[model samples]
Target: MTQSRRYWIPSVAFCAVLVTGGLAAWAETVYVQAKTAQLRSGKTSLDAVVGNVKYGDALDVIGRDGSWVEVKTAAGAKGWIFSNKTSSTKPSGTNDTLARLGHSMRGGDASATTASAGARGLDKASEGYADRTGVSARDRDAVDRMTAYQIADQEVEEFLREGGLGEYAK
Candidate 1:
């Protein structure tokens, strides 16, 4: 009975160590949240870059060192990336309000009030303020051009692909 007890204790201890080690080595999936992220050989920014990932890219998080996370890309490349650049959840889509508004406006079903407001350029209060501030038409045109510019989804996808970002890298 004494011999059996000794063997049982060692077996239980061995099993506990195995379980603990397995848990420590467990990996979690994380998605890239930045426009571009560099996978470095070390935890610091000064470390050599091993690879690059784009927004919405997925990685297997294997370990962590301070603010840096060790990750493995889908291609099986291992490196460290900043923890702030990754998210547990995948990005839903673009959050650009102006882009959404532009799509709605170009859909040809905008309300009369919207069309009127756009065509009139500025409300009376705004026009008065602009005149008082000496704002020029050139400045307004430049603003309009900047606001009117919209990045197409295809273009963004191509850019991501070219940069080996996100799903493209997968």
Candidate 2:
């Protein structure tokens, strides 16, 4: 009786681990919106069509090979799809807003609003964020451009000091 119980416990534990691993491997999901989606297992053109996918269909994505996503189609056809071709549902306005702010900062158009104050605030914010993120190597150009605002602020301060505007404070 004792030997049978020991074997049964180990078998049940092994099956539980396999089942959990399998569930974790099948977590991603995707949807096909184009007329037909091309499924490829690899970068090679030899990746055969696991199946055809249709428009507005949901798929259970299993894994990825390079840039290709392995998915099971709504009709139960499993295959791979190019990552770039996947339709992303991000909000359009976010991109536009980021672009506008990026352009304004890059162009150094301070006169848009109290130019000096605006530039100082943006420059400080950018530097603070960059320091915190520490992965600013990808943001080098942006951080450099933002630093321009700090330079501009120092220039204004120097002009005021040399022009005797500093006497006004006394």
Candidate 3:
């Protein structure tokens, strides 16, 4: 090959790589769906925590293996995160609230982990329903009790393992 042609070939190859990398980034960009997610060093959450991601945090898709996704954080931390903790689309106002609620329900501090209910939880529709409906104080108390119930992480892990759930089936 001619000397000039050899240089041109490498330049073309470099450009191709750059283009492919850019496309891959946009194709599967995922946002953290959990209020706080630990990015592990391996496919399972049992691995060492390499980093942490919070709700709505954008993560560049590096690769995927079953229910685990390899990601690079904006701060350049690379690790594997469970697919259940991420979403293909960015979180919106409603999604953000849901994610926070999920975190709070999972035993996180109610006031710290989630946005105030008065802001996101209470809206015109909910207020209207409450005003029109004749939900008794006793029934409301029962509902509150049920919603306050929190499951331990160990129980969840055991359930997943015993049931062969998620990546465990593989």
Candidate 4:
């Protein structure tokens, strides 16, 4: 029994090391779960965008920095994408309507609202959601062309700083 116990302990330790080593050598893969994930040059939203990965796109994870993930795109683009935008498993419904919305979030009559969505305020309805639960789909989508708001990181930082949200908030 003593001899068997000694062999068992060593065997278990060896197996543990082997398993951990094998897992470490294996590269982790993730799929983009967001409508559109911007691959940034760095691990921050303020970083320059290197590429865009669509929903359900597979990404090879190379490393991780905080909430950011370093990945290599199928097209050979190496960049950082937010960890929250990716999924451990391949996403379903890749061919679904919502998945086919394309890169632009704004759709339908997008050219209608035009310049009315800016500092002047939104005087128009844009790309209304289609809910068949209560309202008719046709009635749900009132008008389109809602101006997309693309606020820069700098602007947000300035606002937070002005409000004295705290130190190193950015």
Q: Pick the candidate with the highest lDDT.
A: 1
Candidate 3 residue-wise lDDT at 24: 70
Cα shift from native, residue 135, model 4 (Å): 9.9
On the 0 to 100 scale, the lDDT of residue 116 in model 2 is 50
Candidate 4 per-residue lDDT over residues 1-170, each given as its tens digit = 99999899999999999999998578799999876767989987668889988889989899998888999988889999888889999877646666457534655444343273445332333323233235454543342223334677557656756775422235
How does each model score on lDDT?
Answer: 0.78, 0.60, 0.76, 0.71
Ranking by lDDT: 1, 3, 4, 2
Per-candidate clash tally: 1, 0, 0, 2
Off by over 4 Å in 3: 1-28, 95-137, 152-158, 167-170
All candidates: CA RMSD in angstroms?
Answer: 10.5, 22.0, 9.0, 11.2
Candidate closer to the true structure by lDDT (higher is better), 1 or 2: 1
lDDT of 3: 0.76
* lDDT by residue for model 1 (5-25), tens: 999999999999999998756
Task: Give me the displacement of residue 168 in model 1, in angstroms.
Answer: 27
Per-residue lDDT over 39-69 for candidate 2, one digit per residue giving the tens place of the 0 to 100 score: 6545433466456665556677777676567
Better of 2 and 4 by TM-score: 4
